[model samples]
Target chain A: MEVTEDIIREVEKGNRKITLDLYHYSFNVLMSSAVRYKNHKEDQMEIVNNAFVKIVKNIKTYRPGTAYFSWIKTIVKRELIDDFRKNKKYKELFKIRDSDSVQESVVEPEVYESMDSESALQMLNVLPPATKLVFNLYAIEGYKSKEIVEELNISYETVKWHIKQARKKLKSLIIENKISLKQ
Target chain B: MKEEKDHIDDFFKERSEQSSFEVPDSFLDDINSKLDVLDQKKKRRGGFFWLWTLIPIGLIMMYVLWPEDIEINKTKPIVSLENQETNAEGALMDSMDEQKSESILISDSLTEENITQEKPLNDTENRSAEKLKSLKNVLQDDVKKIDKLADENNPLWLKEEIKKQEVFNSSNSNNESEIVPPEVEEMAIADSNPEKNIETRNSNINATENAEIEGSETDFAIDENVNNVVVSVDSLGNSESEDSIINNEAFEIDSVQIDSLPTETEDQDSTLNVEEVDPSETMLAGGNREKGDKINHEIQLYGGVLNSSSNLILSNDSSTFPMNTMESNLWSASFGVMYRAKIKQLDLGAGLSWMKTGEKANYGTNTLEMAEVDSLIFIGWQTDSVFNQNTETWSIDSIPLYDTTTVTTYTNDSIFYNTANKYTWISIPLRFGYRIDVNEFSFIPRVGIDLSFATGSNTGTYAEIINEGLTQNSSSRFILSYALQLEVRRSFDRWHVFVNPYFRTNVTPVISSAIQIRRYNSWGINAGIGFKLK
Candidate 1:
């Protein structure tokens, strides 16, 4: 069923069924980007539940009849970022051992067209944590390069490099999967 | 270069547009637990607020009912006490009677008319209780002064009464409440036999006997003796004054008004406005989901029979089956999964499906001719007579080049051959449809595009039109098709049973050539059921 303003009000009040439905919706929406370390067996459910807890706590701050999804997405993203900040692996993934690591070329544009959304998301997650975060913010989440730079607190070069690496990683994965451009 | 980059962006856009996704089942349980916690918190908060609200009301009641700053009148009426103990008892009886009068005033004040209307708020009900209490205190004070008043003359008692009646006089001037005003009290006493004034004093001698009936309206049993004194003195026949004292049952708990009634309509109007209480107003345990969950695409699996016809029929005889098209009444079955979206009554879908479009057709002739023969010509009889000129006497000399009994034989007779053009394609269809519901049934009308690509195909007789004369073999295998369908569906729980009748025509000819290509139009009537799995 389509969620409406009234539904959102009910959802806020902790109406069990409506809240559950709303949570499931939020979980699915943010899971792909939020649960980055899929191979590490990171619990997407736990991350989403925590995000929901935050959402419930701050639901009153949300304006009725406003863009609820965008507001929720922001909260979910923050929760994911908090998780990343807490995880030691996330820190290691981005720590520069040397300043001169090889940077790959931009991915072939046709590669994205070829893969289905599920496979594409999986491929997207395979990128290094910093690169995946930058790419998702820029490409899927519609954040600008400047905004990402500020958000990640990285220099312009590193930000651009991460975006490039994310694309290259996806392009490589597409080639590995042997899928071609399909309409 | 820019266009190529745009293509990449478009790819990402399309991929990201697939936002309607599935999640793990346990997430729902997590949400449920969070909501339960939220509900518990909400309940606690609500109870807390209610408790807080009650405190103020409770405090106001206490403030009104508290026995605060009650002072007794010191100077007393110089009435002679025949016996000291009996005067004390009479004083107690008068106090009890005043208490009853205070109750009646309280009840009168609490009526709906008084509560709702504010003009009369501080009228009879407001000061009557205070006056009654003051009157009770005066009776007590009078008892204490009885010994002193006893020393004075009996005539001085009435004169002293007249002299020190300032409070009663003030009550008559200030209060319009039912407890008798001074004028009425005086009139009742004046009409009374002045000879019975002494009798009035001794009649309430038993007032102190049963003062134990406290906090009860039925203290009327003890109040009767006191009432007789007033009733006998009330000889002016002013029954209303008598009724006032009789009706004044006084307070069961000595309650007092905490606040004045609000006279304005605005407050009442505001109260009415606040009644639209949201039943679902709950303190949320978790964040709310955005209202952007679209009509999500579902994975649907449906299989049914279909009949299809195409321009490319394989036939030995080319006239009836022009361009060697695929014939009609060809029953074929198909099954495929669709990314389906249902919006209210509207149903939308796109899917990849495969089906064959052909059946075996019969045309005569077993002979395989390299070049097709056009026609056969007959010779005139005069042509053979040229031979007769040379032999005028040699009559009919073998009809010249052809003799009289000449017979011509053709190559071969047409045979009953069985051959068919079987073509199969992987078709992708996008449909937009609306469903109308009636009871347990729904009628759906739909229109969409079908892009059919050749996946597995057999050329049939089109292969037969080879190098000898005709040589065009279509290399193009993609077809852009359109369809119209009507589906009647019956839903049962999460499963739906439907029969869809559809007609499809390829916008791009099945035979893509600009030349004499025939268009393929096909119809399918499928009966299938789909389970809703989200």
Candidate 2:
């Protein structure tokens, strides 16, 4: 349903159901973009809040007919990037590995059967930011490596390399946890 | 592998699962209450704005529409007082004329009865006596009526009554035989309205008698009264002609009195007169006097130590030529004194300033950075300029550079560097500026031409490089520079404390033998504190 002034009024009047509904809609859109970029739920909440403040403050600047979710998604992505820059952690997390000059091998399908959904996500969180973003955009969001390179302003080779590294890291994390469980 | 794909896809799906976001109930309540207070404040402010605007408008409308009625109300009493004064003077004259006519009638009656009543001695005398008694009775009765009318109608009756008492005392003692002649009496009787004439003549006679008795006591009063009457009559007849002459005489007398007054008293009284004086003329005189008192003087002592990394006088192009990093922080202080004369708001000044800037830098790439460069530029400039709060334009010309430096470096495993780069030159900086001021703080942006003339023989080893510097290649050339300067100052009495920040750019090429060693531009930022004493 379209949100109107009446919905805002109802929300302001302590109508829990309506306020929660609208908030959930905005939160879902923002969380999807944040996880796609960073693959970690730990920092996702802070990034989403920052994006939410920007959206609320500059709501008038948002043009309708354009994709509302994507517009909010871009803000979440920018906020994450800004946070990394401010902390001086972007270089460490995204630095290209010397060995991964070309695309690395993708994880085999057999590996997925061994882990549940929750375990798989736990493994994805441990992957580095560049690897995680590349994997999410390529495997999950169905973006091509060339498109990812254009969007992130990196070389096509860098995109291919990040995805391969992500798969290797996730597969190793699952295998290491499995061995621990067996022991 | 298919199961692995399914697990990864399920992980993404699980991560994407959205949770509801709920705003705290207290936050909305707090915002609504704050908004209510804001609305109240806004309403109050809007009311105040309209109230402020309406009061002056109402006052102005009242002044414009009601001025004529207000003026008439003020002038009405003054007009009435003038009329009262005029009427009093006319009544006094009329009474005096009536008194003269009455005296003549009395003399005529006395003479006519005396001539008619002459018979056998005793009888004739008795009849004459009775007629005289009857006439005395009529005169006494008429006098009583006049006294009653005077008491009821006249404000000056008390003074008149005192004069009448004096007249009665003097006339009672005067000669009794000066009675009216028959021919004169006949002429008086022949007048058309004899009875009225007789009464008027009796009043006139009584007035003459009063005048004679009280003449000494009332002389000043009578003279003043007569003069006022004559002036009032003349004024009424041809007021413009008479008023001009009277006003001129009055003005001359007033001026003499004013001139003789003490100057201090006149000055004190001038404040009172200011309201009375024409507003436009007073404003003009006040403005001129203030302008005449305008004076300005400035003294600046700006001394600071500035440390900079390099003497690389080239613009930084980060993509191409890397910065020649250096470590040198030079400290310099300058003292300047300026005296300005202001004509109205315009200021003209001349100032002398002295400054010394020195720097040392390591030149060449990392392996070749063994060479150290040292230099000093001593600047002495005398400026002639004009400045106001808005704008300033100045011309400065003086000997600028006297430098001594040594450089040593290894090239191809052998030492090669210039150790001397000392020389003197004159630089004239003609600057034009505009400033914007907030409170007393100002931002001044300036553009200028730096004209340099090499004065002496190039003594430094870097003279070759200097000759290779574009403008220095010629004996004289121009360098364009743009600068933004901000001066923050607080003026206290005659002294001012100020901090100035200056950023300057050079826009001319540096050349040596048609080869460019340094580019034509350089940028520097300097901050210093200074005081103004005037």
DockQ of each: 0.16, 0.09
**Regions of candidate 1 where Cα sits further than 4 Å from its true position:** A23-27, A35-42, A53-71, A85-94, A103-112, A179-183, B1-13, B67-534
Supply fnat for every model shown.
Answer: 0.44, 0.15
Q: Chain B TM-score in candidate 1, rounded to 2 decimals?
A: 0.34
Worst 10 residues of 2 chain B by lDDT: B250-259
lDDT of 1 by residue, B211-328 (tens): 3322211111111212211211111111222122222233112211212213322211111011222223211101242322335334456777777766543434443223343233
Candidate number achieving the greatest TM-score relative to the actual structure: 1
Q: What's candidate 2's DockQ score? A: 0.09
Cα-based lDDT for every prediction:
0.52, 0.42
Candidate 2: residue B287 lDDT (0-100): 21
**What lDDT score goes with residue B433 in model 2?**
46
Best by lDDT: 1
